[model samples]
Target: MRVIKLTIYEIIFIIVCITINLFKNGMGLERLLLPLIIIILFGNLFCKSNLEIKKNREFIYAFILVFFLYMSIQGYYDYTNVSKNNYSLFKALLIQLPITMTVFAAYIFGIKIKNFNWRISLTSLLLVLLVWLSIEILPIIRYVRLNSITDLIKLIIINIPIKIYYPSLVEEVIFRGLCFSGLLAIGLSEDKSNIIQAIVFGLIHILNYEQFSINIILLIVPQIYIGYLIGKIYINTKSLTPCIILHALLDSI
Candidate 1:
């Protein structure tokens, strides 16, 4: 693995990018640009040599194309939200169907699947359940006391697509697949990669920040902390499927 570190110039560039991201709400395109720049710069840091590339032509091509597609769809979604023209949850999910389908297609056609470790996945599932219960158990009890089983089932069915597409697949592909993997490829250790990506995951929620307050800190902490768990799971499993399911389950409950 090629380990690359930021030079002074690259650090300065990142600082500038962050400054631009701060104005992302006021200038919508800046949000998109910052992520693209990040992916390109960091991704290229540990890219393979020409011989390696030639040997893995198919894999490299697919990976690059899919990464770009993921970035584009995510950028558009961010743009819509920032511009205050975001679709309803249901409609937004409907819009994501095509993009999600494309991503799955790329995975199927471009990548090879190896042995998946179900044990690691199960551990991830347990962690997800624990996390969910910690946050939502009280509300869930209230809901159960007030609602019938049929009503609960209906609610779950209705939210399934949204939960799967948003928090599970799309978000995982972007953060764990793109950001975390890119960091690892650039020679970061697993722990460092997880932490960096988790922090970035948390910072993205700043877009939803209403004001500087204790509540904002609380909101960001959970997102970042959960992101760290998800990243660690992805690294352990070397597969996104488990994390996707786990994330959807967490969000649904």
Candidate 2:
């Protein structure tokens, strides 16, 4: 077998992505081991070669540039919010505008965006509904309590745009557009790239819990599955639109 060489940017890109997820919440030695171990195992499984990396150096550079720019803006927003204890629409816009522009540019450049296909779109939508009903609906029903129809409507109205733009659009762009497509562009097989991105997607949710435990680790399993499904949708449709819509609908619930 031929040896696969990774470019420096490729290594930095991978490290930055992992580091962002691992340390995003806070540094805790005890909380780090399990997720770190899992990440290592997944990395070994998926990132066994870098021939693709060498061939796709320009794409790697572009991906790194875009990812870092997004993170920098996001870091600024987070810093200002924490320091000032003020959450203003302007502050939020500072972050969202860059993300919106990045996603738009990504689509315009065809980085995971494809020509519209109604059959695939419809199938993707059906899959999204099935996922919501089977995996998400029960928990939502159990946990979400609303006072009245007006309140429900208000919540939906307020959350739909936020959920769609931020998490759905931002995450789909990063994981599907950058990570998954970047891997594929660099020569990884579709299966390996999908699993790796999905694992990273799931692992990042570790930050969502205040405290770590085996149970908290277990909860991320569903996220991995969801990420895998989203990756599959992107692969099938050759587009981010379905993936973004699916993610938005899921989060909106």
Which clashing pairs does model 2 show? 52-186
RMSD of 2: 10.7
For model 1, how does the per-residue alpha-carbon lDDT over 67-107 read when each residue is reduced to its tens digit?
56755665666666733465476677676776675445345
Q: Which stretches of candidate 2 lie over 4 Å from their true place?
A: 1-58, 79-84, 88-91, 102-120, 143-154, 203-222
TM-score of each: 0.54, 0.59
Displacement of the residue 217 alpha carbon in candidate 1, Å: 5.8
Best by lDDT: 2
Residue 60 Cα positional deviation in candidate 1, in Å, after optimal superposition: 13
* Best prediction by TM-score: 2
Model 2: lDDT of residue 154 = 73
What lDDT score is found at residue 207 in candidate 1?
51
Total clashing residue pairs per candidate?
Answer: 0, 1
